[model samples]
Target: MTDAVQQKEANTRVAWIAGVGASAGLGAALARRFARGGLSVAVTGRSRERLDAIVAEIERAGGQALALPGDVTIESELAAIARQLVERGTLEVAIFNAAGATRAPTLDLSAGQFEAAWRVTTLGGFLFARAALPPLLATGRGSLLFTGATASLRGRPPFAAFAAAKAGLRSLAQSLAREFGPRNIHVAHVIVDGGIDGERLRTSAPQRVAERGPDGLLDPDDIADAYWYLHQQGRSAWSHEIDLRPFNESF
Candidate 1:
């Protein structure tokens, strides 16, 4: 049988998450949720150790997962991620969760730093969509979800690079949705407006956590649910974009 045929016959409950590490973060939470729901998740990121750790967690939960370490900004590596997923089974959901966050004032930002943000945030999304489209289109119905932040909608001072990159990603999602919605594919962008309640952030930005107050941070599991909801939305009345934030967050 052809590889494609074999893959089709293999477990087709495949979901691809890019740019998230395996532990105590959005990626880990998302991988677990999909795994529990019976989808084999393929997770990619820059850290092999973290990805492996995540895979172990899923395996322990009786959910199949694959850990592939890669840089989202690299085209060849990104393409490999898609190929690996296709080898496993049908690519039912492809999530562009990678982003670059080099916060700095415009006056102090170096050219290289600015470009790096775009490379991962904007160009990375483009390449991921490009790589995932064929497999997704083959299924005739799949979800392409991009995770966005408040920066996606506003260019705040001291976050020019990050904001610009996020804005570009949002724009790309809109364009793809318009062009491909009629083709039976769902493309949605989610705006995550507040700080995420994750171990990584708590350790790194304790002050921000303290400032946000009790229940002020966004939950990763909650965010993952939103993505799954987008994936399962009725194609007839699909949502192109949704903004999620803590109730206490300011607009």
Candidate 2:
């Protein structure tokens, strides 16, 4: 290859998306989408077994992937993942999707319950963003996307803990977007305002799941497409937030 071709290959961009939960159909779909785009991906989560499985699937589809097993709540683990990625090259995009939620009356909720939700929903995102910042800044142009829920923007009873944590994440996104935009880093928040079709829903309420229609429920691939769009946006036309829902789903 010519020197120019070699230089271009050496500067190839990679992306990392943290969080691959048990019911991570969305994450998996996003993996496939990125892989198809010819970008190497590092998928992070707490379970090595699950992460390995996802890597295998991505490789089988002719995509390059690395499985980095770690908990977002752990700082050391997050730092280690960042180091590994830096060794490979610059990270062009980082998506924070590691979060958990619980539904219950605020008056009846326990301290532990609230703490767990906050740790994953807000604290985890904070740590992940901090760990990924250096690499993004080094690249000079990158994208930081945060996956959020409708609760992040709206308050509802029986979802106080989840809502609070999500609200905090939204605020963080806004602050970071302003801080990072001048640095050539685009920070955006994605609000998923509807249910995602997954195996759990299939088994729990098959009829309702079917009623959501083929395209009536949000798909991880669709969300991944949105992420890609934001990543490719020019600095002059950057978007700070985007809301996605099923075509027929009521928001």
Candidate 3:
């Protein structure tokens, strides 16, 4: 039988996550969670080394995963990755977990820096959706998930660029939901409203991590669980957006 035919017969489902960074980060966590759920996972990022590390860990844990390293901001690259995913199996979920930001005073923020943030966060999301949605529509079932932040809700000083980018991504998710939900495609925007207890923060700001204390930051695993839950939701009660934060979080 043809591979496509075999794929249909086997009903193999795949999940594709973009913007994977360190193994201890949310993108890697999401990959591991989905793979453990019996779905083959494809992870993409600019850092091939990091993506490979995440794939290795997932495979070590007896979960199927592969690395597809590329720039999320590049449409051609995303299209190629989408083709690769189609060859592997039926893509049931596509998550845009990529992020970019420039923390500076509004007056000091360069226009180029502002555009860069939008390119990575918002435009990257748009390109990924265009590439991923075709295959998803072919199956007539799938989920397109975007990762947002507290910045998605409001703009804070020194984070105006970040906030604008995230907010645009959130709106894109909403528009996608309205356009595709009726076609049985689930689109969700997850607003991560607080600090994440990930490698980046722990390494960059140890003092901040300590200040947060126990369970003060959002756990990547817990966030992954929520994404899994969203995918498993029945169409009767679809959720378009959800915010996540630690118990001690002010917002």
Candidate 4:
């Protein structure tokens, strides 16, 4: 291919995956994948120091990245980030991966705990979608993908707070998909059924690590590859939801 054509092909691809939580071992892996593909990335989280560190790692590996620190629960922050990205240029894809979970018996869960989970998982996803709509519409084509869990599809004991929040997210994803599909924007959700290898598993509950099999755990790179595939789908054949689990994982 001609140099100009090759450069143009590279320039059109860009992705912004939000939420680099302690459990988001997948986010860093995904960031590396996108960076290797020559896409400029923006990684956001509540911790500025951690975000900066992730940016540094990406850059050191010859990838371009910007660390955007903000809480998804804050509407103003979401708006500002959206505006900043729009000002730079088109945002071809956006992945809402920020999630919060509270494991407790349903009866023991306090009002505050329930609200907090909702704020992070459900409300945060809503706010991000609302803030990003205008710019995504401006591009005339884009993808909005959410990271979900098995709780979204079914409720289980000891996870009332998290289950409710994830269920709400699933509903939101479906509603958005229907509302925006006609506008050429793809809205989808991925239900990750296995544990991710991150700080949480490494430090808090090493025994749980075996649940994801001898492969260690579902790598963020694998999940990121799935996101990339969803983004590339045609309008007619778009998939709205996908459930992924480690090979050794049962149920």
lDDT of 2 by residue, 1-251 (tens): 68777676557678888977543577766767777888788898887887888888889888889888888998989999999988666688998987777778989999999999999989999999999999999888889999988999998989999999999999999999999988989999999888777654566668987788777777777788988888889888989999999888786
How do the residues 95-167 of candidate 3 rate in per-residue lDDT, one tens digit apiece? 9999896789999999999999999999999999999999999999999999999999999999999999999
Candidate 3 vs. truth: CA RMSD? 1.6
Task: Please tell me which model should have the higher lDDT, number 2 or number 3.
Answer: 3
On the 0 to 100 scale, the lDDT of residue 32 in model 3 is 96
Backbone clashes in model 2, listed as residue pairs: none
Predicted candidate 1: what Cα RMSD to the true structure? 2.0
lDDT of 3 at 212: 94
Location of the lowest summed lDDT over 10 successive residues in candidate 4: 5-14
Instruction: Give TM per candidate.
Output: 0.95, 0.91, 0.96, 0.91
Clashing pairs in 4: 26-220
Select the stronger candidate by TM-score from 1 and 3: 3
How accurate locally, in lDDT, is each candidate? 0.89, 0.85, 0.94, 0.83
Q: What C-alpha lDDT does candidate 1 achieve relative to the native structure?
A: 0.89
Q: Model 4, residue 41: what's the lDDT?
A: 78
Model 2 scores a C-alpha lDDT of 0.85
* Model 2, C-alpha of 135: deviation from truth (Å): 0.6
TM-score winner between candidates 2 and 3:
3
Worst 10 residues of 1 by lDDT: 4-13
